[model samples]
Target: MGQHESNTKLIWQVFGFLSIVTIVEVILGIIKPHGLHFTNFLGTSLLNWIFIILTLVKAAGIMWYFMHMNHERKNFVNSIILPLIILIPYLVTLLLIEGHYIHEVMGSYINWKY
Candidate 1:
């Protein structure tokens, strides 16, 4: 009972932090500054880079604190995270390639003529 209550309080703290991060992300999205409009590594825009880093930070914090991954055993933690690590890059690559294909198709083949 005591331990449960302690964990409940910790969960609330994590939720609060998550909420704050989400709010900041929304604000940044709404108030996008010109300074962050430049392209950086791999041609990813600076604004997109900011969003990606912040999103990853929020994800890691949630998984570590809210999901209690930090308290799990070594094998348990690796089993979940290692698969995600392997899959995310592949997913991103597929998305990027498909996006570029869509862009080229729309730009070249989809001529608006009536």
Candidate 2:
């Protein structure tokens, strides 16, 4: 196949996959089944997991195809993604830990006041 034809095919493939994923996400949101309502993981809810996964998939599609990061130099890709990879986890952990501390303090103070 010619270069233009190959690129067109790849673009179509990505669009098709994203469309299917988007449809599924929408269906899941509308369904919102009972079992999925309260499912929890690592202090995060299952509905939260669904939203996070969908957002990450969208982010990956934008970064890889829309932004053309997949075709960029390896060093450039790493330069942009590495800090996000590192910082996101660090920030999440910091926020969760601080939230727990606040929860504990509030629980104790409320108990003492009553």
Candidate 3:
């Protein structure tokens, strides 16, 4: 059927997009650009923030197409997404703060002659 063909095409398109994003992530991880590594944002390197953001984007894309969330009502989608939107950043911020604190405390011991 024509509808089936179109759906198949759309699926392939989404698959290609997802693959490209994944490839980019892999390349970035392998290269580990020094600028990204050295530049700090939110108490962590820019590279880490980029990885986290790209991961979230991939997750959203997977949910949208594979999980059929795009077909759901706006209200329903918002209900499901809103809590995650609120929670993910909150958790990441807490993680960064705690991690920075721990690193700071530990760094002081590195140069001390025991």
Model 2 agreement with the true structure over 78-102: per-residue lDDT tens digits: 9999998898678766866787688
Alpha-carbon error at 83 in model 1, in Å?
Answer: 1.9
Off by over 4 Å in 3: 2-6, 106-114
**Best-fitting candidate, measured by TM-score?**
3
TM-score of 1: 0.73
List model 3 lDDT by residue over 21-60, tens digit each: 8998999998999999789887888989999998899999
lDDT of each: 0.77, 0.77, 0.89
Per-residue C-alpha lDDT of model 1 across residues 7-106, encoded as one tens digit per residue:
7777788889889989988987888776775455544557776777788789889888868899899999999989988887677667767866786789
Minimal lDDT window, size 10, model 1? 36-45
Return whichever of 1 and 2 wins on TM-score.
1
- Candidates in order, TM-scores: namely 0.73, 0.69, 0.83
Which predicted model would earn the best lDDT?
A: 3
Each model's Cα RMSD: 4.2, 5.8, 3.9
